[model samples]
Target: MNDTTRTVRLSVDCMGGDHGPSVTLPACRSFLDRHPDAELVLVGTEQALAPAAGWARCRMVIASEVVEMDDPVEVALRKKRDSSMRVAIQQVKPDGNGVTMADACVSAGNTGALMAVARYLLKTLDGIDRPAIASVMPNQHDGFTTMLDLGANVDCSAEHLLQFAVMGSALVSAVDGKEAPTVGLLNIGEEAIKGNETIKRAGELLRAVSAAGHINFHGNVEGNDIFKGTTDLVVCDGFVGNVALKTAEGLAGMITSFLKQEFTRTPLTKMVAMLAMPMLKRFSRRLDHRRFNGAALLGLRGLVFKSHGSADALAFENALNRAYDAARNRLLDRVHDRILATLQALPGAGTTAANEPPAARHAA
Candidate 1:
């Protein structure tokens, strides 16, 4: 359990997302009410932060520019230097007094733009080549499955996948209190010979790391295995992970819509729905995508979480809570130690040119 006495400060991009401050301000209010030891720094234009003017445990940072939801990564990086998104991420850095400005940052802005700005500002953690987006998804076993590379890096090498596994293991261990989280390499099939060259090579690396007592590798798992809770963490390239995530979201929406239509089709069915309203409510809550809106951009030197662009107040609140949890648990430190240990356990792992790549030489 995390220490409840310590305060967790979060910087929020209040002018990002479709609803902008309208959604974020209310969410902040609710989040503050729920977490007494938490503080917030809302970054946005003056007008956008009017609603939160006199809130306790919250302050406003004036950002001149606003990053639109459709803003391109280049535009956000080059044009909108003072955008709310960038300002929020900037708060994650250490101050002159050597104290961290904020524990974490949360934004519901353009995904590509957010990634670009975050990478430029926070940079990657030691032993991390590229940062990956990781989030929790509900599984059939009534527990959660954490999947990574959710649209961060579309193309990845075997080494990148291995890094994702190491990072993902640390995340689940820190956040979920798992001693050694089980990792599954996402593949087309469960067979050892099923994936492409990159996946097969990644599997080999994962097996080696598992043998070294770093991670609990569960062989390979298919797409269905994600929902089956076959493993605590699922590793894949961003392209496949993004597709799987969006597909699951779409399927959940479709199922909800179909159920609504069926229940209202006739008076008898409507009566049955009313009779089973409690069960329906429970089912709807279980499948609500809003409950799982926050996705952590892992492997960064500082913490940054992304919320769905279309997230409402409730959804945004969940994203804030997720960020707060990560900060409170000192997730960054855990990830750093795990990655260092994993790198040390590799065969012939040294700083020599022939032993490892130049980029990975100082990863530890």
Candidate 2:
């Protein structure tokens, strides 16, 4: 457990997303209202973040630039060195006294740029070759299933997958209060020989670590298993995880759209819609993607969370809340400690990596 007495400070990029300060400012205000022990370092242009200047427990950090939603990774890294996205991430870096400005960072910026800037600034934790993004998806059991590599590293080796599993487990255990979360290798079938060579090897590695008491391995799980809540965590490469996330969002939208269409299609159909309104509302709320807006960039030396580029005030607030929860639980320490312990138990497994670097851009 973490000591609740310490204030959890967060750095926020107020000008990164589509709506920019219009959306982020309100979210930050709402977050501060709920968390009396939290402080915010608002990073953006002077004029852009002027409104937050008077807010108590908040500090304004001037950023001359903003990373647009369509900005390329190279431009964000080289050209826009003073971008709010970059500066916000910088808050997590320790100062000359080894004291960090913020406990974590939250941004609704270009996913690729955020990941790139965060990795370049914080670097990866020891034994972690690359950082991965982990987020939760609503499942059937009235709970969320944690999944990782959600578009950070499109191509992953068996060892990289093992690293993701270790980081993801720490995330769940820290935030969700799960002592030993079960891990499932996302594959086409439940059998050990179902996936490609990389996945098969990953499964073997997961089993080895599980037997050594480092993780709780639940063998293999198919795509549908993710929605079934069959496991606490799902491990996969970025390509698959991104596709799955977008597909789930699309399905939710479709269901809500279909209901709207039926409500006004005809008078007789309208009556049926009215009868089902209560249940429909419940179902729609269950699938709203806004409730699960924050995605954690794991394996970094510090904590960084990415919110949807188009998130509104409510969604962005949820992202801030999630980051606050993780920080208060000492998520960074948990991830680093878990990785080190697991790697020490199985030498030559977590530190090794493939020759190719991660892709230039993550999935938008």
Candidate 3:
């Protein structure tokens, strides 16, 4: 039997994004309407969160400061201790009784600040080195391909890539309900020998873990393989993953812009576009980056998702949906189980579970 009545709570940084409460408030209201068993803890300044005061199943956590979009990670982490982003993440931290105020947290603030604050507040899970930003992209099969290390760690070693694969597998298994999803090492070619030494080494580790019945390693995949849906998940360093993500978004934008130009170029083109309106609309929606707005900061003790700062109501709502789904499905537990099961198989891993241990510098 399926359990549909489980209550899931979320702590949202209402003042984190570009539009602040204006966008988040509307999305929060819509999310509450869709999920009756869901609750929200909105964190922000009193003036910013005034509109949500009367919302049922919602509580406001007053934060004195709002971390600016350009605030340095150091400032956000040190100076603004009471920033909304920090406070929202704090909601997911377990209390003395091992109970958290909220099951998960969501923020559309500065990416670096979010990561720093989240790590400072929740810390990394045992057997996990560093947290990676994992999110989905639309694939050729009309499904999503999960990719990680978007921008969390600019430089990642082979061990970090393996850790990302483990965490990503757990995320997909928990949220997408795939027990053993395929994992792909993003490389220049399908062959394992194509990438640099780091990727090549990561491939060997992934294959070893797969042979042990841990993850379903799918060898190496090219840049185009991401959209080809060649595998269930793509593992790459933050630099490469972030570039791939931005390129995909740019391509989507180009397609939309091209369609609009064709529709308004001339009367005949307009008629042609009118006839193809339904198909074009479907294509547009399929490639909309806004539909996939939330990026999970994996390998953490608690759940924290990052949304695009420019996300509108629809996009922010989708981020909320992702966070809610992960929390309700117990993604944290799944990640812990996966890492613990495979920790010993991979050597020199999980040495950086502390906030910023010096030993992490020597991780493979």
**Best prediction by lDDT:** 2
Can you write out model 3's per-residue Cα lDDT over 1-364, one digit (the tens) per residue? 1345667889999998899899999999999999999999999999989888899999899999999999999999999999999999998887655578888899999999999999988888887889999999989999899999898888999989999999999999878889999999999988777989999999999999998888999999989999999999999999999999898788878877887997989999999989999998887788888988999999887899999999999999999999999888788877877877677565665544433221110001
Give TM-scores for every candidate, taking all chains together and pairing residue i with residue i: 0.93, 0.94, 0.93
Give, for candidate 3, the lowest lDDT window spanning 10 residues. 355-364
Instruction: Estimate, for each residue in 265-327, the C-alpha lDDT of model 1 and write its tens digit.
Output: 999999999998999999988878888889999998788999999999999999999998888
Worst 10 residues of 1 by lDDT: 355-364
Q: Regarding lDDT, does 2 or 3 come out ahead?
A: 2
Give per-residue CA lDDT, model 2, range 103-125, as digits (tens): 88999999999999999998888
Model 3 residue pairs with clashes: none
Alpha-carbon deviation at 97 in model 2, angstroms: 3.2
The alpha-carbon lDDT assigned to residue 258 of candidate 2 equals 81
Backbone clashes counted, model 1:
0
Report model 3's TM-score to 2 decimal places: 0.93
